[model samples]
Target: MKLRYWLAALPFIGIYSGGTLAASTTFLFGLPFLLVWNLIWMAATAAILAIIYCLDTRDEAAHAGAGKGVEK
Candidate 1:
C-alpha cells in the first residue's frame, strides 16, 4: 500500500514487457533495443531500491539523538 511498493512493481512490469520490447529491431548507440531496455531497467531498479532504502532509514534518522554525544 506504500508508495515504495508501487515503485517496486514498476520494474517488474518492465521485465514482463521485455518480449514485446524485443519485437522492435531498432539499434540504440550500437545496442539492440532489448539491451537498452534491460540497461535502463537496471538503473531504474537501483534507483527504486535506493528510494525504498531511504524511506526505510527515516526512522533511524529520526532517532538522531541516540547516536550523538551528550551535549549537557
Candidate 2:
C-alpha cells in the first residue's frame, strides 16, 4: 500500500476511537450519537475507496501507455 492509501484510512482510525472515547449521552436527529457517527463514517470510507480505485485505474492506464512502444 502507498502513503496515500494509509493517509486515506486515517478517518477510520478516528471513527473507531471516537466511538469508544465519546460519551453516550448525546443524540443526533433522534438517533444515538454513535449510530449517526458510524453511518457517516461508513459513507466516508466508501467515498475514499472509490477515490483510491480511480487513482489506481489511472495509474494502470498510464503505465500501459508507457510500455506500449517498448513491447515490439
lDDT, candidate 2, residue 70? 90
lDDT of 2 by residue, 1-72 (tens): 785678587776958876674585688899888888888888888877777777666677899799878956
lDDT accuracy of residue 63 in candidate 2:
91
List lDDT for all candidates, in order: 0.85, 0.77
Top lDDT model:
1
- Encode model 1's per-residue lDDT on 7-46: one tens digit a residue: 8899999877986968857888898888888999999999
Q: After superposition, how far is residue 10 of candidate 1 from its true place, in Å?
A: 1.2
List the pairs of residues colliding in candidate 2. none
